[model samples]
Target chain A: MQDVHTIGKYADFAVGDIRTFAEACGVTLSVTLLSLLIGTVIGIIFGLIRCSKNKLIRFLPLIIMEPLRNSPLVVQLFLVYYGLPVMAGILLKDYTAAIITLSLNTAAFFGVLVHNSILAIPVSQWEAGYALGHGKFSTFINVIARQALRLLIPQAITLYIGQLQCSSIVSLISLRDITRVGQLLSVRTMRPFAVWGIVFGLYYLVSFPLARLADYLAKRIDYTY
Target chain B: MAMIEVKNVTKQFGDLTVLDNFSVDFDHSGVTVLIGPSGTGKSTLLRCINGLEKIDEGDILVDGLSVNNKKNLKQIRKTCGMVFQQTVIFPHMNVLDNLTMSPIKLLRMSKAEAEDKARYYLDKVGLASKEKSRHNELSGGEQQRIAIARALMMSPEALLLDEITSALDPEMTREVLNILVNLAKEGVCMLCVTHEMSFAKEVASRILFMEGGKLVCDVSKDDFFGSVREENERINKFLSFIGE
Candidate 1:
């Protein structure tokens, strides 16, 4: 009873601590941005491949993405950060491993969404282009690819928010993102309210606008079906 | 030689034979109407002539060149324009864009030239003022008219209309049939697959009766309506069915 009371009282005194909060936020933003950029690239490639008629080209991405999507991101990070060096003879720096792991995991989900959006484009659109003599590659690029990008925004933002939250797990890699600092602050201050509130609020600051932007863009993009 | 020759064309999808040894020769001028019961391959025959569907056996020739080769398809398709059963307008695009897309993209016309051509054809179809209106904003009749003008923008030598007015109201059908009559007067070779026997009798220079996956009867408009005993017995029965 005394310990809980003392811990809660002590954090109120240090709620004004700005330096540690800023450091953690800076790290969180960096990881999220890097991870998102890498994930989007991987997602677009595999998403296109999954819809491909060629068996050999399509199967390779399917193998990688399924396990990445079905398994835990934490487990993936451990493999890239820890297991690869031990078994696969590949060594990666902690931050690089975190970026790689986050990207791979996010891409597995992103690829499925992107591919679905592309498939949702009606067959008649392709027929119309073809009847005009547009070849296969040009048809997919001009018709299918452009519309898929426009449709992908809402999904992408949701993933980015997930990515921002997921950045916390990378602290296990010792990169010191915002959530890591909040955890340390909570332990020292023993104030769950002050520490968790500040951390969760900072995350909201990063993610809330993303959700809103996605909603706005999804409404704006032109699509027939 | 006939401009378009379909000889012993057999088309099958798995075990179901859609067209069996179906053959017809569509001349280079005026209109030819194909009348048939449903599932007799009238629409399928029209599609095969333009290479939209490949025949399983035998051959189809447009202007005496084979359409079976991909390399030859570009030149063949350019000469053949098709209006589908349903009004398939590019819904996202406006009336003018619908007319201009193939002209600009396939024919490589300048944007200004394409726009001018679109206006001319849209005016012909009586939708000159609806240039900025999207496809869905137009009525069913208006949409089908725009589809006609879009096909015309390609300046095809031959046009294949697949039940182009079947989905329309009577007034709308009249509007399309009137356009097609005027187009036929200009000597566009037209092969129309339709249930509109009255319209076909009014416009077609020749009429074909299809049944059992074959061109079972072929005759001029006058002889088909005239009293002739040697004319097809199956055709007589089919004609009586329609009359009833």
Candidate 2:
């Protein structure tokens, strides 16, 4: 009886009514993927820069990472969205701002992860590669990177999942993400439990497969000996 | 010119002086064993030749070029190949690649030229067919033979053997020694720093005895263990302490 509403709302929502749900899914996935690509590029660049012999190049990450980690992403998103328009005289979309904030902030995130992964390699491996007459950069790319990749994968997966979950909070600026769509439907239909049930189930559908895929890939990784 | 000249070379790590004003010349085309107790700077001396460890005092000339000077270190390294005790043969590469790397990289030989040269050393070490095998596929002696071949691929004028046989079993040691004998016969000037007294005697044209950090006595194998040679008395005392 508490679930009853008007005839139009009594029936469950149409499949195409889920277009907003589709848009939320597509938007969040697209943003996270772009963020990951950009974040990885930034991280690798700075990570090697961190290992550079030149003091100036090594200190570049210090300038980039400090403010990135200090401020909240919410505030970062707002600053980029508002400040860029004022300075450049060009209006930016919400998704563009979200990707930039996520990419720059997670640059430091992946940078630290990459540094620790590189240092984890044994000194003998370095000696062996050097003995083969590889210069430092060549040795890093050919030998060290291949070894470090095995360790970097799990941390990257964790970052991606976190990014996916964090995408929900981005709807605070009226972005129409999954959670926002669910909230809108609940208010319109006045059926909070059923509406949120559909929302929560959709998220599980997205997240559970990714977690399983990561687990499956983890099992396939060959670190033996 | 001396194949290798080490003059008053000293290496100090903080307060611990590993090699104290050590000077030696490697000129002979045969094994010259450096027999001493552990931590007696045998490996330190070998590393100095390969330009891996820089000496704090004094200079090293490899083939008459100063290894102490950074400019000539690479040139010196290309001419003097070193084989470590734990001579891992690049587990990721096949034996052929392991052998060919130095020739290609340091000697500037083309890949085809390097591989062709690698095959010669491979055959010399009796590993012609095993060239295509991954490093882990070989036995310990086989792996060491591959490592030796890898070192030789540089076509080095001199070789530094640092306790290379100490890790192997007796059978493996014999196999490695046979290869070294062949190398010595080819007139490759060698500075072999090893603890195997018997191998030292069999292969060495000369022997240098060290106690602590000093080369107390240098003698030929004929007089070394046959009759006690002239010593500083400290050498005799230290030799007895080690029960050698």
Global lDDT scores for all candidate models: 0.81, 0.77
Error of 2 at B101 (Å): 4.0
Misplaced by over 4 Å in model 2 are A1-7, A53-93, A150-158, A182-225, B105-110, B126-141, B169-171, B226-243
Fnat score for model 2: 0.09
Residue-wise C-alpha lDDT for candidate 1, range A55-169, written one tens digit per residue: 9987989899999988888999999999999998999998899889988888898898888888877776666555545566766765566666677778788888888898799
Show where candidate 1 strays beyond 4 Å: A1-20, A217-225, B227-233, B236-244
Write down the TM-score of every candidate. 0.88, 0.81
Question: Model 2, residue A114: displacement in angstroms?
Answer: 2.4
Question: Lowest lDDT 10-mer window, candidate 2 chain A?
Answer: A1-10
Best by TM-score: 1
**Model 2 lDDT tens row, B167-244:** 889899989989998888787777888766667666788888776677766888777765654344665665566566
Give the DockQ of candidate 2.
Answer: 0.28
Best lDDT among the predictions, by candidate number: 1
Error of 1 at B24 (Å): 2.5
How accurately is candidate 1 docked according to DockQ?
A: 0.36
